[model samples]
Target: MRTTLDFTPLFRSSIGFDRMLNALEAASRVETIDNWPQYDIAKFGEDDYRITMAVAGFSQNELTITQEQNMLMVSGQKAGEDEGQYLHRGIAERVFRRRFELADHVKVVGASLVDGLLTIDLKRELPEEMKPRRIEIATGEKLPRAGTKQIETGKQAA
Candidate 1:
């Protein structure tokens, strides 16, 4: 069964969340998206994540990883044609492209391919200005005296 969601209500009340809502809506609309080359997303730490993809018949030269803004794209295309005739072929030998939407502050640190598995590491590095900070509050008794004299001006009044 297929279902459609109405985001009109959410758009009316929410502010500055258009990107998030659009991503959610796009994900929901693509019900029959391809699931080839199985993948796994795991979190090792609070802000560290890894994406592992099973690319059995693909090589490092045939795969490409790109990052644009907040989107990460991984694509693979087999090079050259099969030389020998196969009686029973089970492995998938086709081109595929996968996209991942990353949140703000999340960046692709590194990627490695070993034994048919492609692992991409991600880290969320928040800026110093955006990190949590403590604000100091002054007590009532520590307030400046209202009767304090103002600094005298160097110029003489006419």
Candidate 2:
């Protein structure tokens, strides 16, 4: 049985997290029956990741990868039906589309298809300003004080 999740309460209590909540809601709506052309996501390093999809009968021209904003979409469609009838069809050849939500600063570096496996590589390249930085603290004596220690009359009589 499939269960639904309501995000109304979270919507009211959260700020700037609409996209995350929306992704959760979208995931819940995915149908289990539509799972085909299985894929795997693996992380090799802190900022390096890969996605491998099984596409036995699909050619490079039949598949397309697109990236828009923070979303990565991979889709494939059969060019033509098989000419001869198969005694027992074991491979999946239907059209399929898969979407992956990417985090900020994450980028798709390369993709390759080998031995029926479609491998896509990703890397996280944070911009200079967005990367972690250290703040220098001023010591008590090192910090230059503003104004004089005590105030005195503007001028003295001749």
Candidate 3:
């Protein structure tokens, strides 16, 4: 048995869509980054989003949130204890980095910590120029007369 791979037709048909082809190529190479400290991404509305990360035992000062380019990076590092003797240390204070891809015009509003949960709010507002608008078609262009097409068949115009 032999396996033959054929992509000439697909490639030839998508010549005019270099950007889309590149996007598909890029998407194929997307690697699964590690999932650190669990988090949640929620959509509140058409232009609202919220990201909540499980940051127990992490103080607000230990967490840093920054937005660079089109990526939202959240990092955590706990303060070191100098004069503490731990017999059985189970809680992990190791630093972790989590990244999220942000859409165009999306921005981080602010972050707050409550009940050991860190909440990060993000919002995306569409520009006025990008919003959809209703256009009223002129009365003449509404529709061709019902009998107009029948004229070609020698039928009397009603």
Candidate 3 TM-score, C-alpha based = 0.66
Residue-wise lDDT of candidate 2 within 1-158, one digit each (tens)? 88899999999999999989998998899566666779999999899999999999999999999999899999999999979989999888989999889988889999999999999999999999988999988677666678766657888879
* Model 2 collision count: 0
User: On residues 1-158, what C-alpha lDDT tens digit does candidate 1 reach at each position?
Assistant: 76889898999999999999998899789466699889999999899999999999899999999999899999999999899999999999899999999999999999999999999999999999999999989877676668978799898889
TM-score of each: 0.83, 0.78, 0.66
Q: How do these models rank on lDDT, best leading?
A: 1, 2, 3
Which runs of model 2 end up more than 4 angstroms from their true locations?
1-3, 140-158
Per-residue alpha-carbon lDDT of model 3 for 85-157, expressed as tens digits? Answer: 8998787677998888787788999899998788999999779899899987787566656764433676787
Please, what is the whole-model Cα lDDT of each candidate in the order they appear? 0.94, 0.92, 0.81
- Ordering by TM-score: 1, 2, 3
Clashing pairs in 3: none
Task: Point out the worst 10-residue segment of candidate 3 by lDDT.
Answer: 1-10
> Which stretches in model 3 have alpha-carbon errors above 4 Å?
1-33, 136-158
Each model's total of backbone clashes? 0, 0, 0
Looking at model 2, residue 52 earns an lDDT score of 98
